[model samples]
Target: MSQTRSADRNETGPDRGVLPQRLAGLGAALMVLMPLAMWLANRSAPLTLGLAAALLLAAAAAAGSSREVAARLRRLLATPPGLALAAFLGWALLSILWSHDKAASLRAWGELALPIVFALALAASGRFRPRPTWLRALAFAILLACLLVMVELASGLSQRAALGLGKLMSFVFNRPAITALVLAAPTIHGLWSLPEGRRFDRILAIALALAVAACALRSESASARLGVAVCALCWGLAALWPRLTLTAAGCAFVVAMAMAPVLGIAARDGLPSLILNRFAVMTGQARIDIWLSFGEVARARPLAGAGFGTSATMHRNPVVAEVAPEHRLLLGAGHPHDMPLQAWAETGAVGAGLLVLAGLLLLARLRRLPAREMAPRLALFAAAFAISVVGHGAWQGWWIAVLGAGILWFGPGAARPQGEDHG
Candidate 1:
């Protein structure tokens, strides 16, 4: 009977460890190549690669331990971050009922949900933790991509002007903002991980961080510069008081929302001339104008909104038309360039609120981690925040892929052995 029971136990055990391991290995390979995927293919390619990896991760988890995967999924759904994301996605889907462009809204919803699903897979798959080797590979890939950009800049890859900035791009479709954003997170991670690394790693980290900063400056992407600055501030705050970091971040968020409209108006009223000149002034004014217009759209439909992806169609708001007539055509076709405004304008107050809730929960999670982990996470968060405040279209496929990849690549690596070097 003992032998019979033992045989039964062996028979009923989860999967053969080999299968899950292979799946996981395959997933890791895809994740490591995500940077190159983004550079060589369309924006969707990176996300496609990430989604494939995530699905494989899920498969690996299920194969390794079905019951464990189920339980983890349940636990994730109950968590604040999960709940918030679920709510936001649900609200977005429901908005399609009233959306004028059903097809477009559905596409937007799918795009928004894809990243969430990918993130969920990462968080739930306990065995699929980010390996340091994979992280290093991604960093090297980014460095190579940056080198290509530098070459392009030197050789004049294109005669087509870059948003009036004359900044160069890789011969490929890469942009300064996207490149800088990608580099910012890992560079911050390198600095944060320096104390715990070997002497060689310390030198490498310093060199990488410096190179990333130089790349950002040379790229001359205002958004990337802002992201870098915000990351620096976050790192400083993390070093000072870990507990207070969340409070200050929350405060800053609130202050920014409160001041967005006012600042936009001020910029239109000649404040830019007093503070900045030339390109800076023009870009600042453009952001301000778009932000104010989005505010108008949100105010027009405080409850249900005009509907997801309907920002383009709903730009006839009298306030936006009057306040920024020159922007009317652009407003009819472009995003507001601000995440909160994008949510509020397209998905209504409920969607925006859920987004805020997700952010707060993320901050809460960060608060529980050590300084070394906290610093890099905070840096990445800062970069995402800054970029969102002045970004491309809300539902831009490539932009979504970039943001998702950044989070996936940098987020899970925060975990370390108990005695590892910390910030």
Candidate 2:
């Protein structure tokens, strides 16, 4: 009977190992798939990832880790940073009540809400240690994604044309390029964090970093290029004096959110011809013009904003006539091309304040991490923040999802050790 019981235990042991290892594999695959999805799925990638995350959570529960996961998630949600993010989301939803277009507001709210929810869900579910295999997979994804972008640029988007994806492929690579940039930041530290990393992982890490920088340089996305620049600056500063960078970053974010509309005023004076014409960058002049116009919209309704999701259509608002003709002419560009500016234009002071508070709280929380970990996260945040300030609309679903994906890549708990009893 003792031998019978021993045999039974051995049989069950392999069964237990299978579930956890597979779960870890799934988590890693999701990370890789998320970046690749940026190319094919476009704006819908966020929703795709959110769905995947939900499925992951469901599977985790069914694997007999439900109670432990739930308890951990509860503690996280109850923390100051978690509560702050919830409050910010609540305020954003409330702002939709005042949106000029209710239907659009609701749709936009779903885009923002879904990603935030799933990102938190994943964080509460597992622990992602930087294993050699995971690092290689992460690096390979970056290389593959960047190479595709390079190929498209070289071939004049022949693949997109072949697919009947339309003729206007000028900025087609923007989404994927930016996605690669975000992933690359975390990948940098991830590769570095791999203990006892093999020669392949080391070579892959170097190659991956070079590929990301090259993609950012070669891709048409101005934001991706700027991300590389911003990331380097932030990464260096954070590595040297993490606390200083975090404090400055937190303060800068608050100020930007608090004063989004008028930032252009400080930025737009006597510099159009000097910077816009001479710089020869694609979006330089256009960005300044957009900033000037959207600043008026935000200035028009500072306290309450035009309402959530209004920046995309703020030009149609009667307020355009009130701003200067030069500034007003560019309002049709669909967005401020700036994140903090978008927040101020849509959610007004109330929403912006909550966002600022959440940012500060999050930065404050990072203080608890050792400098090694905190530096990389700070670099990621700073880079993303820079992109938001200069490039993407703050609330765009894909961009937000990409940011969520960045956290999964950089933050703890995106994966777990194998051979665990629970998934």
Alpha-carbon local distance difference test for all models: 0.62, 0.73
In order, how many clashes per candidate?
1, 3
lDDT of 1 at 10: 48
Best by lDDT: 2
Which regions of candidate 2 deviate over 4 angstroms? 1-24, 127-130, 163-168, 270-272, 279-282, 318-329, 411-423
lDDT (Cα, tens digit) per residue for candidate 1, span 191-234: 34544455655565655566666666666466666676787777
* TM-score of model 1 (CA atoms): 0.81
Deviation in Å, model 1, residue 156 alpha carbon: 1.6
Cα-based lDDT at residue 14, candidate 2 = 33
* Candidate 1 lDDT score relative to the true structure: 0.62
Clashing pairs in model 2?
Answer: 127-413, 127-415, 128-415
Give model 2's clash tally.
Answer: 3
